[model samples]
Target chain A: MDGIIEKAISLRFEIAAVILFGIGFINLLLQSNLIKKIVAFNVMDSSVFLFLASQGYIEGRMAPIVTNGVTDAANYVNPIPAGLVLTGIVVSVSVSAFFLALVQRLYKHYHTVDFDEIMMLAKERVE
Target chain B: MKKDMWKRFSAWVNGTSEERGPLELPDTAVHHEKKKLFELSDEQKIRLFKAGYLAVAAVVCLAVVSVLLYTVFQLPLFGDPNNPAVNDVVERYVEKGLEETGAVNMVAGMIIDYRSFDNFVESSVLFLAVTSVMMLLLRDKNNISREEDIQEEHERIIEKEASDLILQKVVSMVLPCIMLFGVYVVLNGHISPGGGFSGGAVMGAGLILYASAFGTDKVRELFNMKTFKTVTSTALLCYAASKAYSFYTGANGLHTGIPLGTPGAIFSSGLILVLDICVGMVVACTMYGFYVLFARGEI
Candidate 1:
């Protein structure tokens, strides 16, 4: 129980990120507005980034910058997670832009932003 | 007269008029109100169903969060040196990265040299995303002349006094600086914290700001669909070719004997700087292309 408490105290941010992920997931699942769903998706993406980057953190270490003359491993945090998060951020932006474009097209076609209304219209068209 | 100009300038910069109007309800709310006339019972039933669904979703979300929190308790503490994430591989990258890649910025060196293949794929993904967006949105023009006329008229109005004079002036002054800083970030990635992705994003934002301040036609003359396509394709191709060469050389145990110049120098990191420029080009074009396509349905 003490170990669990210590873990909880140390990984508070990660726990918060997990909660954020859950909230985003629930929002994505429950929200019918396409824009809200997109926002929720972004929230989830950011939470995952936070979790990964936090994993790479070491106390008293600077960012992975080779400063002054120091080249020791202990002087710098892990660069891998930061680099991966950078790539993830770019991918998220592109995906969000593409999704928004699709949303725009859907609005043009059905004149609505609600997923339920769009699905209803689609169903009627199919029938 | 100058004060009036300043007032008009501030208003234009703020993108709002002096006359304030009452806030209007959103279209969805208005539509729902209209639908309440005949479908009252159905709306009530739907609301009740939605409430039930929300409660269930909330409970499920709580359960998931609890499970995740429990798992978090099993994971290593934040900033623990003995954590598996701070392993031998990361240690090597942190220690010998400057010597091997000749990049002062270890993160840049690691991404652009040690893990370059991933960066290459990420750049290609940006290019692919823009291509997909273009495929989805680029419409064939049947009434070309009519569309051109409309575009011309729009441009004329935008270029005329209707456009924000102060915005145009400030963007004109700031845009070159933004572009130069972006290039600096891309070129100096080896020695600094910024890299291709960030530099490209800044450049894209500058292009977007220029397009917004001036008319799209003016910005199009500077960077249109052809320019975007050419830049993105060339950059992606170069990145893939360079990474492939490096991979082949490493696999065959052949040292290409490329000079890794002194760290903190601009041209130090053999092909990293060149690849940085390529990635920057792809990212900038993708960003600007996305904006143009989304705004006008065609670029």
Candidate 2:
């Protein structure tokens, strides 16, 4: 039963990751809307994070602390992944903020948020 | 499915997690169309300009002092433990009688005894910031209708498309609980992870919630410029004077006259209570000032 559950969990993870990446890829290729593409990008990113975070929480491990309230080895999951993820999260927030600000500027310049309209405006400006 | 999986699989490659985006969102329509604002008056322009200036100043300051801030913070959290100059101070005054201070509030003890001056400076900061925000909000603008009924005033702001009912409901429901929890955290600081800093923050959260949910007019009803300034200042001055009194009078220790009732008990510590109260008020007022600045987008 335990082995079956493990297999199911692994399968679920792989399936989710593949679906997320597929959505992002398909949307980028097919969708004309730039905002929709960004949403899809976020979906893919979340799936990758989900995979990393789940793998880090290994079974039967304690949180890092000194054994017997003194220095001795105690079993614990490595905290490096958590630290990496924290930095990644901050970067992601910064990227999103910059992206949105850029979006605002684009909207202001073209007076429209449609992709084809923006292209037309750029062409006009160049001409 | 088995056939698909098994047919000569290649070595798994872990690739870039933050994908290189082929799709740019420059022309992407927002999921919702934001309603257009008709005009920005002269006042709004000034507010926007002032906000921009503050943002620029903050960025420049961070660049300049980032290293100094990092080192100052690091010495306490991750310093050379065995170095004599650093180690001896920790060994004698700090380590000795730490338990006898009967203060389970380690952060409080550290603030009040080790670095009381910094704490005082921080409190003065709260007083000054609050005064500035109040002045900003209540500046020489004419005819902001002084409605006696708060609920009526909130209702009137609705025509200005003040936001949906969800925010008001959320703030009213959550603010009281946050304030209650803040007091609880501050009171139990001695034995727990949280202290006056976090507690006062929670209280500030409550005030901000109320103001955001209702409006600044309702806020004025709740607290006046004069009362808020006077109270916070007096409390802070009292905190400074306590230390000065002890120092100049040649008191043996803070523990001299005060009964150290019982170890680990809340009131057992000599000056921890006073320190906690001061911290709580400072944190609360500082947060309130910040919220006013944020809500009004000035000062």
Candidate 3:
């Protein structure tokens, strides 16, 4: 592989993350489907993780482990972001889990998961 | 052209109600009603209050911006009096801790010693979140699964079809293998990157498979809601009780607890076993919650 292209390939995850976020954001704004919007929210969250992990990447770095159980900082990337990512992953999962429950509740209450149907139902419920 | 004009004119003459959509209010005296110009409901009034607060906040922000601009040329306000010196001392302490522990995982030392209590608290938080979700969604599945199981079993047994045969054979073949893998992951959590949570999820996946393959009826009969709740709660309580013992007695963790045991050895972290079981239970319960809701055709 070309040197420049290899560097870009290493950054491909961050690029894909941004692209997914943008796509999901546009779809969220344009689409009237509630399920799709929820899915878009999740995609946006995932994009952050992708960007984060990419930012932590370094050329010719070892995994965040000690070489032969000795303190050698020469080959290791920062582990703070990875630890932070673990926390973020947990938060993301919890948010998705709760959101899915709410979606279930919404579907049960409103006959359809479509945004327009939900709005119509809300208007009816209000009256 | 005259006839076409006449037809269009007639429609216009009728005021084009047909052309207008249903939501379009008719411009007629009968449609008019006496109503308040700003009769806000309770929720709307609260929203209006929030809007007012936001406007106030905007003004405050602008005021702060002006103040900051006015003070731009001043030295850094509240500059740390002992900044570099304090950091120099702190770094030395951290370096000493790292050297003494002989564990290259600096973060682990920071986590276990400096902020171990915080981790215990955080673990409790996760346990709470898991428990809350289980408590909320579990009730529906417990009752519904039984009825669904019975209905499905009758259908599968009575039918002598190729698809049924295929599904039965597939499920029977795969369930044992998945279960074994899940157990392997859980048991050897301390040895590798894989741990209780991932292993538990894999185990739960096996149940999901069993449910999907053999039918919900068979799964309900085999596992049931009661079994899940009992085992899950029991597992969590047992984990908490052990932790309580450590907290009270200071007996120094469950595993072979000496100097991280030649790092990457199977018996490294003393707490890994405890961590594994807790993670496994959490994953299993969450997976079961998903399977139950989804199998109801709610998805």
lDDT tens digits, residues B64-101, model 2? 34543333333221112222233343333333324545
How do the residues B37-117 of candidate 3 rate in per-residue lDDT, one tens digit apiece? Answer: 123344587578657866765566456444533333232212222222224333432344345433344444333333445
Report the candidate with higher lDDT, 2 versus 3: 3
The CA lDDT of each predicted structure is: 0.85, 0.53, 0.57
lDDT of 3 at B154: 65
Top candidate, metric lDDT: 1
Rank the candidate models, highest TM-score first: 1, 3, 2
2 against 3, candidate with superior TM-score? 3
Chain B structural similarity (TM-score) per candidate: 0.79, 0.60, 0.50
Worst 10 residues of 1 chain B by lDDT: B17-26
- Residues B41-111, candidate 1, lDDT per residue (tens digit)? 66787789889999999998889888988788888879998898788999899889888888889889999
Note the DockQ of each predicted structure.
0.59, 0.03, 0.17
Listed in order, each prediction's TM-score against the native is 0.84, 0.47, 0.62
lDDT of 3 at A6: 53
Model 2 lDDT tens row, A11-90: 45444555565555555444446676566666666656654444444345543221232211123333333433433443
